[model samples]
Target: MSDWMVTQTPLPRRRPRALSPLREHLRDTFWFAPTAAMVGVFVVWLVAQELDAALVRSLRDDGDFDTLADLLRFADDAKTVVSAVGSAMMTFIGVVFSISLVAVQMASGQFTPRVVRLFVRSRITKATFAVFLATFVLTLLVLTSYDSGADPLVVASAPLVQSVLTLVMVALSLLLFVMYVNTTLRLMRVSHVIARIAAESFRVAALMPLPAQDGQAPALGPVTAWVAHEGQAGVLRDVHIARLVRVARKHGVVLRTVPRTGDFLVPGTPVLAVHGGQAPPRRALRYALSVGVERTFHQDLAFGLRQLSDIALRALSSAVNDPTTAVQALDRVVQILATLSRRPLDAVVHRDRRGTVRLVQPVPGWTELVDLGFTEIRACAARTPQVTRRMLAGLDDLLLLAPPDRREPLLRHRALLRQAVERSAPSPADRAFGLQPDRQGIG
Candidate 1:
């Protein structure tokens, strides 16, 4: 979800802030949410302490000795319960997350390392850790307030509210634990993981505006200057597109990013090619491009396709020859390519108010995306009749939806699939079956 780009300003005249690389980093990590939760639990513990003291004072003053005695016993019982829950909670946290990490690791091995991002981004996993740790902390604070004085009345400054609150926290932690288990289990399933990847891809696609039917924009004069990257080497994750557009308009220049999103960058790599005029300040242009250790779906449109293909490739590998799983991955790939067939996937062109091109952000075109999605799978699945048949069907379906201009890649891939099958299949029967389009591969 952190991949959700910052919403761009509707009116170009208003300047929008650049996307913060730190925000993306935090969203990809696991620490911030649990740390905040513990702080919140500490505050709640303070409030419960005050409320418990207040209730004790009110009861003692009313000379309700009998009720106070019962309250004292209840507080003692609650303390024991809270202590047990608190001590057990840390072990529970360790066990749950340990199992979760193993599950995530196994999945990464079975599918692709990219899928580890899906597990890391899970909100349920974070919430479970937060609440479970918060409960443990709450119990520790509540137990510290318990007095061992022989004077019953004095000791009756009972942690009544704190005890009750701790019990409620314990209950909530149990509930989240159940939900976390369910979510973790779902993450392990191939079908579920494939569906999640597809869903995220579709979500990113939805954010892209349909291409303009017709438009003419001012052309760039020529390359005026080039801006080299001056940061830690990493993947070019996302660009602050709105901010680049604003900077370009302000300087009366055309700014073109040299590297597309998802490209690996070392320091001094040409990141931006300024056109029409000299480059903007290096700092100004630097922050507009967000570089990170790995790629994300937020700005890299091809990443989803890449991930799907990776899954299929892994499935078809000799180490794990599961053509059925490869077929399933193709199912989603077909859907994604079909959706893309209708949309304009040319380089994302940004224009100024006067309809002059200001920023040209390069992205994968239809041909490149189609090739990225199919080429590797086609080669790897060359002899697997199930995957070959399914791929043929998927390409056929895409051909029907593809515009005339976009059909070339599909037709080329179809031809390649047949050649691959013919070369790899052991006999004439297998070759014929492999070439035949089967929506379900074999069934």
Candidate 2:
């Protein structure tokens, strides 16, 4: 019944493989969505141009302009108006960007540097930018439709419709700019950033659910050759296990990886080793591995934990000393850890066609993960009673519903917290209070 309840159902069998770093990188970058919008708007502009021309030709043939005495004509004056609006829109865009960047920089300084990625990857911000740029682009393109020097009677002039559409675009851009400013301000708050990160982490945990481990990590005895990482160093975000299995099968050898996902692999670092046969072409093996500028949730599930933990540590540091933030981060960690408790961990035993074990890629187990999530923050915040008490409460909460396998580690971490409070609290009463499970201190 507790919020940290760890009881969970085993996940369905997953056919896991490496996520393409390039694909994920592009998705997170600022340009991808706007670039797509640009292409889409260009197509719309072309279609709108043709439709406007057709409307003008039809109106002229049917004497509609004569019938309407109040109709605004496409003239040199209209072109001048649109040109001015386009120039003004560009200027406003510059202002919006400048202000937004300042806000983002301030957030990074006050909150966490990684928080900036949220603003950069925001769909609303990207859409707002796209709308502003699209409107500017549309205004400029429609200017070419002007026939201020040519006779309206002979030229295909559709000034009234184009000008109206441009005005609509301007209105839409203004609305979007307002929305961007509001979103930017809302995201500046630390609570919103942490909540967003927590939400994303839970989504990732639920989507790429792990299964329970059957046993200890499988052993790959006597690898014949060690294969180091190639090229520039980055996080070894993912490795193609299927390819490794195939390589193992082809060589009648065993392949063993040196590090886990989320681990950095420097160039010339030993990443893999081939046993019982000649090593597979390092290039062929390297192609199956994905290295990225930083970690991602697609494969490095622990990276989310790491990011939140980093935020907590920074908040608890001497400079910031915000224990409330650390507690918030700890609770979110509990939420995901609870989710993981019910699911399985990645402990692979890849087999060849003959069903013989060919490769062993061991992912971090539950205990390793508990260490990853709590160890650093616990050390950093041992003296912060709010955080220590919250950690105790989190541990006790998870222990209640932790699966039979997880209870031990949860108890182990909880005891470590008790020891920390005992060692750091200034007095007996303070230690007693810090060890209490309630959010309120000394209660």
Candidate 3:
């Protein structure tokens, strides 16, 4: 029953695509690699210290170092052995940890590297601290177990315990990662929607073509001067067409015939019964005037569109918390979008089936309406769902008003409109109303 309820059941959510291999590699390289390396180095150092203690005690008990040189030589050998063993152990642990992390991410349905990167980018400082703390805790646990005296049971269980700890740490990391990633992505998507709306508004403003001040009036060949009487209706009471013709002949420009009053004169269309010799100044004036008029028309369209877009944007912003106001703003936006989409201002060129192209100038004021409409649609697209629904309803209204020929562009952009609607769901503030505003309002 709600206007927002285009469908009763919500559309099924699609599974997001997996991140590409290249993206995964880049994420790992940029975000994960440095932290992993640091942890690995620290772990190796701890292992080597433990190993050196064991070796040093053994060498001292054996009494193999009677001289300082010999003792130093033996110490060097012990250090090398400890370093090799520690390095290998650290490498093995790192590999296990990385594998567990990836597996947990895959299982949690957050396998995309884009998601991971989003998380990393959002909470770099927090995540960095987490990594440091995790490494320290893990190292303490390992050292504690080692110092507990290599009890057969404990030693045998060490690998399993390490694996379990790795899994737990990886799972925790992923949870935090996803939270940050989701938040970042949402913010980014919203920003993009807003920007798109703003751009459309500018496009509308560019439609106006105001005439330049430098423009000149077009020259008339075989010009005739006539005075009009007050309250006269197509009556040339005093001046005859023949007399006008004689005057035109006095000038080099000759009028073979005169057109009847009230004859329509289209731009660029030839007028009959007029010829001129050496009318360079007249030709120049005509060209300048034509260009100036075209420019003026375009400027007007642009200015109108800009104003319309601004109004829609302001209305949308205000409607955020107030349902009634929001609905009204949405309605206005829809009206503007529908008009713009239906009838664009300025001249649009289209090719016919015969492959010949011709410029089509829209009727006056049609351009301004269309520009305003498109701007409104764009602004609505970036808004919250409640606002979007109102916008969509407005669009539907405008569509109804549009001529058949103007519907194609709106239909073509249907997918984008749908996406905007989906993205712009009403916030908690919007849902306080019993019914969706659009559904409750006039169709």
Candidate 4:
């Protein structure tokens, strides 16, 4: 029998209520920024009111009537501007975001749904929403503080600090608007979107750098117990690896994860298998794995590969029939593959300070990643001479970087590509042209 087996027995259902998971959830949300901005703006309004009162008192005590008069005139002039901005801000937010969302939708439809997450998690998107709402709120607060019937000093206090703050907010909102427009337009372009995804994937690769080769894990005792996932079906987004290692060390057991970061989990799915001594509490082990509705690039290194593949596949589809986009995606795919070539792709083993193996987390190795990046594109691009040529070039480039052990997958893909071109291309000339490796496809 296999080392790990799926059993029908159900593990205890324990919902993950950890703060780390909660932080991760909020980090990806669109509403969190705006909500936090609202709370922050209210506090700023109170501070602005106090500062306005203090400025009025100081100016009155110093008998600086001329400067005070100038300030009031400036405030009056700014009132018209601020009021206009206040009223238009919300509508501006709606229109800008609506158009931006439409662009995002079109890009997603053109590329892949995974690209939406990149836009959502963008700092510019969150900053744009936060600044727009804050400007509108601050403007309303400043305008409502005015009173014509009140004394000159009372009215003077209203427009001092608050008016300045509102004006600054308006300026920030305008700047963010320009930036948002530029970003949205760039997002509409396929090259920018593909580059963004590849850049993010590169960052992930840097963070989770693999060793040159897999190190042998210390031997442990036999299997003792199994822990299964008992919750609504979801993707395994991330894991608290440190906590798992600690728990295993304390319990004197070895825990091996059955599914990888991007795998989907349903109830009764074997999540972890215990080896050696006593197993840790099922609750701790279950909570260590953060499962969510969808996969995130947070800990799932292969998510970028998945996204690029999706874009390439969509471009090659009959509905789109855009081979250039596929070639562009293939460009990034090869770049990522080249980077992964120098690193070891193997199961990650975590050990305690005493050199005892505590946890084993399986990940996609070289062959799997190679197949993932090439197989679909090769099959889909066989009929398209440009894409096939680009793919062949990509595979050859990867072959130079990949070590001896890693070259097998690259060689296999190259042969497969030649076979596909021979079958898809009618004439010998066409087959020969398709097999010729060109980094820029036809170019």
Predict model 2's lDDT versus the native: 0.73
The numbered model that scores best in lDDT is: 1
CA shift of 71, model 2, Å: 5.8
> Which of 1 and 2 is ahead in TM-score?
1
Model 4: per-residue Cα lDDT over 1-443, one tens digit each: 12221112222243223335557678789999998998899899999888877887788888886777677777777788888998899898998789778987898888898788877877788899998988888888888776544445545574777887887888888898889888888888999989998987776666552331333334556778888888778999887877898999888788988898989998898888899866677776667888888898776778888889999999999999999999999999999999778664556666778866788777778888888898888889899999999998998888887777679989999998899889889999999998999999988
lDDT of 4: 0.81
lDDT of 4 at 46: 91
Q: Could you give the candidate ranking by TM-score, starting with the highest?
A: 1, 4, 2, 3
TM-score of each: 0.89, 0.81, 0.26, 0.89
Put down candidate 2 lDDT per residue, 275-309, tens digits, no spaces.
77788886667677878786666556676787788
Window of ten residues with lowest summed lDDT in model 4:
1-10
- Please identify which of the two predictions, 2 or 3, would achieve the higher TM-score against the true structure: 2
Output the lDDT of residue 186, model 2: 83
lDDT digits (tens) for residues 244-294 of candidate 3: 333344444433212222223334333323345432233222211111111
Residue 426 in model 3: shift from native, Å?
9.3
Clashes of 3: 26
User: Rank order by lDDT, top first?
Assistant: 1, 4, 2, 3
